[model samples]
Target: MKSLDLSLRQKRILHIMQHNDTYITSAALAAKLNVSSRTIRNDVVKINEELAPYNARILSLKSRGYGFESEDPKLIESLNQIETAFFSKENRARYLAFKLCFAEEPQNLYDLEDEMYISHTTLDHALRDIASQFSDHTPYIRLIRQKETVRFEDDEMKKRLVLVEMLRKSWNYHARRNAYYDDNFIEPKVLDFIIDLVSSNLNKYNILLEDPSIVFLNLMIAVMYYRIRDGHILPYEPPIPKADTSVYYACQDILNTLTDHLHCYIHPEELDRLYLFITANRLLDQTTLTRETAKDYFGPNTRLIAEHFLTMIQNYFRLDFSDDDDFYITLLQYIRTLQRRSDIYNEQYTSDFVKNDLRIELIIAHLFQPLALQYLGKTLTETQLIYLAYCLCGTLENFVHNHPGDKLNTVICCQMNMPFLFAMKRRLESDFGNYLNITALLPVNIKNSFDFTDTDLILTTVQKPITRNPATDTLYMSINMTEDDLARLEHLILQRTIRKIYTASPSPHDLFINAFRHEKTGHGDPYSIFRDMAADFINAGFVTSDFLNDIIRHEENSTYAICPGVAYIYSLIPAEKSAMSILTLDHRITWNTHKIRVFIMTCFTLEDMPITFRLANLFYDEAYDLPKIKMEENPDVLTRYYLSFIDEPLTP
Candidate 1:
């Protein structure tokens, strides 16, 4: 159980991985071994099975191919211990892939047989297997094995998607483990130059790419350069009607520089695909992807569909995202791309994440499907609808968070008589002030279907559920109103009021030992307690020495404890330098006459101050339990208890 027995081929693969850092693709391995890539891939499976005992496994990044991830130096050192004849499936396949992908001249069977160290029969079988893998290829696209050598046909867009995806997703044997093998897919200098060139050109054009898009664009650059260097030329030609000239020209400039660096010939179609990638992902100041240019760029019915989609969101949400020019520009261009992609390929953006699978998004999907069916004559896929939902969510958040001065619309629902209803209405206006706009006053008897749609908060005196309104949260109040009810309702209406109060940040245990640092001792007063914790944060590069001084100064003036045996301290710092530390004492230590057995200190930027208050809220709510947490010696059980507090949901 402690050791694994590996085959000669497996040992060879391990040896290659041990010597090199780049991914070795199965195609490359197959060509070298004089066997099918399929055989090499199968052998890799057995190799991984053996590596299981050593806490190591074969990892594959889509475009990058396959490599190994192992932490144990002894396990890695064992690679040299295993005897091998230098014939690995990975080595052979790598050889074949290089030959087929990069060979300037056509590949001949005789030359391949000699180069691959295989018999004529084996070479013939390998070629047949390789050819069969690409049987579904459109005649002259990408790789097609002819009589002798492998021929590559240029199809830039498809090539980019395939290549980029290869570099992005990885085969994870253990999803829960953060076991990423960082094989610099391409040379660092080349990748850095490509990123800088693309970034500068886009900035020159006044085009803005979000962080995710920036990462994707870099990935694309890496893949494109990698492929072109390997001799997979995807010649691209521009279609008749094109996108924003600025974006097209910007991409052209970037691509030209990239191609020169890569020393490869690129087609216009590749540039066009790059333009499309930028157009779909980035925003421009000049409104380059406007609705006015629909005829030249988008499909015939795209404008109409986009119009209806925005209209539905505006009406349903009672907000106008269409007014946000960039929203329309970004979404309209993306929809056009979606239409084109659907026509050619049926690939979907799939994820099982809770954020993507939000209950509110489900409601939005229900409302959006009918509109898509009416406008496009078909329902959108869950992925497509979820994408639209994200756009809407962003727009809504911008309106809610960014435009806090704007009055939020709310519907007050109650079953009381006229006088009591009027009294409650007055109470709401008094409590919430100008922050809330009571859009509709629905009587208990008049209730039908207006409860759930296009509003911020629903205030109902009863606990009745609104059937159709899925996105908006409802606040229920008893017949007799109290300050707590008013405060909770106000919290729902104006999110900024709780700007300092966050639901959670890095989990409590994550702060201790993982992200920040933790200590458990019955030594020192408050100042010494803080100094010890601050040292860890400073060492972890989460804070500076000045933080220790600040903590002493702040705690000297104020108190962070609301409950017994616990004191939490925090202040605003730069975002990147923001960090937290947790300390638990065996006995209560006095802080300005306040005894504390547990102390959690936080330093964050202004933006992250909310998490501080949120944590404070949790501790205050758990007033009687601080001593219990301090005494809990089992790290696992204590960590789980702390994590439960961090999981509290924010208002949707």
Candidate 2:
């Protein structure tokens, strides 16, 4: 016997039956699939007749509309699989919409609706259904429902929490898919409803939430969210609103608790303006919200989230500020006017260096604006700006702190020519006014390359010795000095020795030098180094052990000389998986035939595409120009250029 192909309505009914655990009503199924109840009833009958042999049948009891019954385990399993696939598709649609809504870019609702293959009205209904699962109200706080928006109101923070929880669940469900979405879409609407409720209470009852600034931030985040959805928000210029001192205090309390457990003080102030600036403006509140407001969303017994922020700041930045402090006042007013206008604080000073440089155009837009209008807030104070820069640099520094120095590969070149040692002392101090361990060596300098074994990378322009101790997995090198120049060599080695080398991974095309010369006596080259010193690095396990054969090849090939005073001897040799090494000889040497002393021995495992100069005329930016040069001049600048990059972490 042949089987009959099911109608679309029958398929829809069967799909719903497989998915739903409870009995489904004909009217409900009809509503879900946008068909008449009569049509759904007929479809169920047809399904019963055709699927009888498969042990699938619809049962209509007294009050229930319809349900599928299948006692066979195999049939139930098959149905379950089909139901799972159907819901997965629906979950994906909702997830995409939510992600689009939360993103900091403009969103086209129509476009997304089309992509999901649902009519605009249908999508609206579905969103409302989702919203209903988390809606509630209180005095002066009603669940605000728009054509395409839904959010929570007073005393119903649980509803808000539920909504976010649902979103999180859906997010996780979709994460394993090829295309994933974030939570940007839900945050804006959720925040909007909360703020509107607060605003209504403030206007109607004249009862301000205990901590309104936080509420205001929540409103701001909503606006920022919308702006991002609409593609109007700027990256560097994020929204900034004043945070409540009450909230900051609450954050501190949480941090205190963590400290009690961890025996480490977490600074509360670190959760200040800078941190707020990074969130989308629309994700914040327009009016202040308080612990009372947080009760519904977090549980009634829950401590305010502000407490967590405070704890985080204290732990991260070691800053502590009270609600009544001047800093608190400054922060509160700033958040209020940040999005709408820019009148909070004035820009105190503009650096001549930053002002004249056209490269920082986005920064310029930020500077001229008021404290409340610039990205997040008005342009950061000169000190604040510099501090943030230092922070950015410091993040890299920390990455360098975990490994042996000899195993490092890439060298970062900057104008200062000092690896992990930049000339931003004044700027760093001004920005980090509170004072921190800023002078500590950047992480990259103190750590081995990304690998944990060695910091073999040299971050200087001076020649250093290639010495090592295997027992402790340590490398000792005298840079920019030779056996012949004992006095100067000792001083150079003292400065070159990084007290701690941070561990960092070598980047693509990252060059690791075994030796480098700081001054331009013009004898830096791979082959120029005495063979014994080169042999020392190999024996110490700094250079690839197979390099001996390559060294012989380099010696035979044109003396491996690159220029008058420079030489480059390298090999594409593979090493053991656990091997970690980098060594350098920075001074001039009289090799087998070459007299050049400047040398760079690089061993790289290329991970990116090689350079293609064929389209140089069209490509605009060439590979060579990719190297950054500082705005300075010196007689031996070129030598320093190469040496200065030795210790710097590779940025690109």
Candidate 3:
């Protein structure tokens, strides 16, 4: 039998076919591999040629596409080995990283080129790319390529950290298959033992950790084990704070067990690091702890930082959280945990279910960044920001729920009979009772005389000439409301209620009317656009010159390309007054990862925070027609198009 050499894509196709008992179509393979059908066919031809000498072939049937067929056991085993080989770029990178980290001395560049079946330049590029990826840990860990030799040098602990990150990234990819047993770095039995060891110790100590946290701990421990066995150990002592006595003992036991199993003396410094890791990852059980009692568990600094954060939130968003003891305790616990493990934990573990709320959470998190740096002594990582955002979102929900007066004072104006009106009222209450306070159910005929001064929203079944209050928003719906009507009404209620919370008085129409600029051709650079738009606001007396620098700084920290072709940028520092500016371009410019043609810039006062949410929805809301906004040439027409989605009445 001849040795079969296959390309990465070919091996992938075979791997997929091996897992699936039936033939897969060329179109399906193309879609999975993100390639053209012609490319898949060409690859299949080459794969077949490679397998011919080994008495194995990829068979293609009419319409059914491709399948692998083999009668020889030795051929099957060889194919399996080829499938498991490090052929993919990501896998190859991992292999190189592991090799460099574990190498006894500098590896010859020529030798690596031959081993990876690549030219000298290709080998150099791969090593440089790896080095760039680990550039953040520069002094602590490095991939040094001196002359024609390559080696990883620096702290053993940093090397272990890099390995853990690589493993975590790989685990994320493999975890989707529900099998980490196939991981190449650690033996299956050793990985299982490490997981069990961590789990059992936590169980014995009455400490709790989320599933993802447990997986992270297991990975860290596995990496630590391998590094220790390879004669690499933590050289310096990490400062260990006084953790829970039980957690301390648990970590001690884990290290002792590993030391005995590996027959290697694990350094005492490892225990300190492990203690911090376990404490940082542990979850506090459902038992509620008051502020005074929480201090005892999380330390006094945790309470101070949590209080400072809540105060900042109140001052910034005007939503008070001082009374929410549970929120305070939760924030304190999170801060304590964050302070301990900020260095080790970097991967994003936020669940996908919260994706809908992520936009708002991100805004809140960005707003809290300065305070996080001030109080926590370090800037929050993206993952930490997300975690903090989730906590704040919960508090915001509580604030909204607790304040009944904040709900929109709604009135239904319909020309239907008494029973029909009553049924409509019941439905509105059933659907939007949380957001709407239905104050009246009146006939449309009485619209001339009815006072809407107290009402925040007016839902009319039929469009009738009525004397309406400027503050009260109006929505037209069918007698029997459709799903679209319900959805629109829900959005209106949410926007109106949030505006009420933030005391936002300017309607969407008013906002656009204040500052709407139609640029025939926008500058190619996004920063130039920002500066130009900021000057317009400054000239109009809505903001000072500092607004330009403020927006630039904010964009640097958190870039918001809300949707495709639309970049929403706002100042973190509230403007001198509440104002908005919309700059539309005939041509698109690159903003972050998005190609943006529309820039919605705002310099809103602190009280106008909810208006930001409403503006954000102009892009986020699917019904708003982003393409229409992008394509419209006239500023007045564009403004009207934007106002069409909002419940605010248009000016004649």
Clashes in each model (backbone N, CA, C under 3 Å)? 19, 131, 0
Candidate 2 wrong stretches, greater than 4 Å: 1-40, 46-55, 59-97, 100-106, 118-652
lDDT of each: 0.57, 0.36, 0.69
- Over the full model, what C-alpha lDDT does candidate 1 score relative to the true structure? 0.57
Residue-level lDDT for 560 in candidate 2: 40
Residue-level lDDT tens digits of model 1 in 1-652: 1224555555556656654567788866654443456878888888788777668888978867888788884445444232212154433433454345445566787887786788877665654543433333312235565766664444444545543433333212122110122233456577668768877998898888755466567767777767766666664344735658888889889888877777777667667667777777654344455556645665657767667777765444344566665566656665765554421222212232322223233333345555555766655654465566665555544554445456566677888777887787788787665566677778766667564566756778878764345445567887788766776765555343233223235534355445443546766777777778777667777677776765564444323343345666654333344566666776766554446676667766544444553454445443237457645534345455666544432232
**Best to worst by lDDT, what's the order?**
3, 1, 2
1-652 in candidate 3: lDDT tens per residue? 2334766566666656655578888977875664568989998898778777668778899967788787774344444433234455655666687778778899998888778787776676677667756754422476777988988886677777677666665243223211211345687688877877887888898998766666667887888887877777787765667648998899889989987886778777888877876777777765757866775678767777777777766777776889888888878777777666543443433222233346565666667666667776656655566677777765655676688888778888888898998899899888777777789889877888888788788888887655557777788888879977897897776556555655446666678887758565558887888888787779888788777876776655445553455667776677667777778777776565446677778877777666666676555553345466656556667667676666544211
Error of 2 at 397 (Å): 75
Worst 10 residues of 2 by lDDT: 609-618
List clashing residue pairs in candidate 3: none
Give the TM-score (vs. native) of candidate 2.
Answer: 0.18
Candidate 3's TM-score reads 0.72
Error of 1 at 164 (Å): 0.8
Candidate 1 vs candidate 3: which has greater TM-score?
Answer: 3
